[model samples]
Target: AQRVTQPEKLLSVFKGAPVELKCNYSYSGSPELFWYVQYSRQRLQLLLRHISRESIKGFTADLNKGETSFHLKKPFAQEEDSAMYYCALSRSPGGSYIPTFGRGTSLIVHP
Candidate 1:
């Protein structure tokens, strides 16, 4: 069975501190991994994708195939970055790709 694990349900950090949200997954074949964030009243938006190799709002995540993990990181945390973050996995259940998200981790950045 394919599964995504997020050990922490909530992470708190002070402004200007570095932060890292851990995510692990088990799956066969190539899987699409993404970090989605919902800020306050805003809709859930894509934060980063393993394939994109791009950083958003100072956040970056690297997909480590050997470790089977995609961990999101930021050099510094901001109060505005506080939000609910979810680690998602996309795999083909048949011909169509299906997205499965972890329970989610709420980040609280204090000034």
Candidate 2:
């Protein structure tokens, strides 16, 4: 079974401070990892994918296969960056898509 885990339920940071959200997963097959974010009263949106190697809204995450982790990071925090973040894993070796998601981490940025 594939499982995704986010250790922190809530994270608080001051403006201009750095932020890191932890994520880990357990799977037997090759996994596709992604970070999703939802702003206040907004729908969940895809922040970035490990395969893309891209940064979104100043946040970036690299998949550490050795550690079975994908931690999101931002050099500087902003009030606007406050949101709920979720880590997801999905990959169907046999072509059936089954996605597992973490509980989510609520990020609060204080000005």
Best by the lDDT measure: 2
What is the alpha-carbon RMSD of candidate 2 to the true structure?
0.9
Q: Candidate 1: list runs displaced more than 4 Å.
A: 92-95
Residue 97 alpha-carbon offset, candidate 2, angstroms: 1.7
Please give the lDDT score at residue 40 for candidate 2. Answer: 91
lDDT of candidate 2 over 19-67, digit per residue (tens): 9999999988889999999999999999999999998889999999899
Q: Backbone clashes per model, in order?
A: 0, 0
lDDT of 1 at 25: 96
Q: For model 1, give the RMSD to the true fold.
A: 1.5
CA deviation > 4 Å runs, candidate 2: 92-95
